[model samples]
Target: METVEFYNGNKMPVVGLGTFRVENNDDCKEAVKHAIINGYRSIDTAMIYDNESKVGEGIAEGLAEAGIARNELFITSKLWLADYGRENVQAAYETSLKKLGLDYLDLYLMHWPGLDEAVMIDTWQGMEDLYKDDKVKNIGVSNFTVSHLEALLAQVSIKPVINQVEFHPYLVQDELRRYLEVQNIVAESWSPLMNAQILDDEVVKAVAEEVGKTPAQVIIRWNIENNVVVIPKSITPSRIDENLDVFNFSLTTAQIEKLNALNEDKRIGPNPDEFSGQ
Candidate 1:
């Protein structure tokens, strides 16, 4: 699997398994195990997802089945909006660790920058403390706008290593991407395939046909070509394997620009600035 290094020098696989709506415990567990068995080393989960225990089970099963040590896997979990206080954030991390059945996470992210800027700042300080205390390998934020990042950066003692957001051909987020680039922070894409909706886009379809690949593969490769981390979720074994098969072909600069021009700044998920703790 291809990898990228965090600001702290920790290596993370560029492509990971995203566990968002894999709600059934057994299904999520099996999906994670299958993903690991098929060579995936990175797994992304969150507190709000409420499947950390199942993910933990899958990790244990995958480790045993693959005969790989725990340290070889890059596991990530997020802190939810309700758990934004300094002390509450630590408790949230502990809860996730317990559910994940791990001593420390490879990456821990703030799920959202709540409406209150002060709360978000406090939550980040708590995350910084966790990193200093060796509870997590790297710290980051999700769904943060450029303005939010600028404010947070002004108050932070430790800069975030990443800013994960809804990224794809349609919602490219160029401004945020540029800011992250200047800050030396990596941009991670949560819905690289636009929840599988991009598979039918004319641009994606044409590129897939020209490249002799699936639309999913083309989209995933687009993220790779742009140096962005991608996590495409799937519980089906074949689809999981297909998502990981994006390393063979490369897109040309012109083709990449063609894909880049398809951006509309559209979003299928909730906006961070107005989220009300869902």
Candidate 2:
């Protein structure tokens, strides 16, 4: 229900539904629809996720059922590594748009920072063109390191409004977060719950008990308290609803410190610098 404003003056819901591995078309569609009907206004998907059509289907159903207009929801998708060239970027964007059955995306991100800086630059330029032409509401990068951002920032004409990454209690990404803050770019967390692995942490459990909330809620609140955008994915209707029930409670300063202390500089996803996109 809370929103974060981009430098461009567009607002994004602080919490969203992430469709990373929700491969079952029926389940993905249902999850998206359910999330929207239950008060979620943001949805995150990607080209590599291969469920854009289903997501599009869900969005249509959710809008019609919820009685909300297309502008009421924020939809995001990504550009894959294979489509990382100036010549290929527009076609890739078009393909994603066609699949999603939407004329434009709320946010379009570079899925990864690929191995070559030149390719990244070219792809970003293509995205910049899309932004200029009103093809996408905003542009950003995912799984990008500070060094990668430095490279992209030095060469690009348009600055990215956000950097989506694998962020959670164990993977806080302090340096990258600081840089993004300085650059006035928002930070979005992909695996905010660490695929539900963080639910069993002792600290998370303690906080959940104290706050009378679920561990998932505790972790989500932590992200919110830190001003990080979180997208916790779920197909189960109950869990999906539970994930969004984080706005009511506030984590005490000490509890937030405890959660922050759990950071080990760990990562569950591929490292951007070394990932070959295979």
Candidate 3:
């Protein structure tokens, strides 16, 4: 698996399994285990997803079966909106850690920017504490815009290594991407397939046909070429394996342009500015 290195010199797999709405414990566990056994090295989940224990179970089973150590994988989880205060942050991290059956996390992110600047700063300070104390290998944020990031940056002692957001051909977020590159922050794509809505678009389909790969593969490759870390969610074993089968092919310049041209600034997820923990 290819990795994108953080400014801190830590590496994360560019492709990983996302467990967002996979609420069924049994199914979620199986999918995680299957992903690891199939060569995946990163796994993303969040407190809001409510499946950390099952993910932990799958992690243990997968590690034992795959003969890989715990440190060989990159596991990520987020601090939910309800856990936004400085005081709440430590307990939240510990709760997530205990539930996941792990001593430390590879990456921990503030799930959303929420509505209050003071609260966001307080929450981030807590995350900075975690990083300084060696409780987590890296720290980042999700659903953060340039304005939100600027505000946070003004008060933070440790800069976020990543800003994970909804990214795809339609919602290219060109300005934000440029800003992140300037700030040396990695961009991670949540809902990279736009929840499967973009799979059948004419341009995506055409590219898939030309490359002789599935539409899903075409979109994943598009994200890869754009230097975005994509975590495409899937509970099906075959889809999980197929999602990782994107490293071999490279999209041509014209093909990449066609995909980039599909950008309509469309967003399938909530706007970070207005979300306010809704």
Best by lDDT: 3
Better of 1 and 3 by lDDT: 3
Q: After superposition, how far is residue 63 of candidate 1 from its true place, in Å?
A: 0.7
Q: Compared with the true structure, what per-residue lDDT tens digits does model 1 show for residues 167-242? A: 9999999999999999989999998889999999998899899999999999999999998999999999999999
Question: By TM-score, how accurate is candidate 2?
Answer: 0.99
Error at 173, model 2, angstroms: 0.7
Query: Tens digit of lDDT per residue, candidate 2, span 134-248?
Result: 8899999998899999998999889999999999999988898999999999999989999999999998999999999999999999999998999999999999999999988
TM-score, prediction 3: 0.99
TM-score of every candidate: 0.98, 0.99, 0.99
Stretch of 10 with least lDDT, candidate 3:
269-278
Q: How many Å off is the CA of 209 in candidate 1?
A: 0.8
Each model's lDDT comes to 0.93, 0.93, 0.94
lDDT of 2 at 138: 96
Candidates 1 and 2, the one with greater lDDT:
2
Off by over 4 Å in 1: none
> Clashes in model 3: which pairs?
none
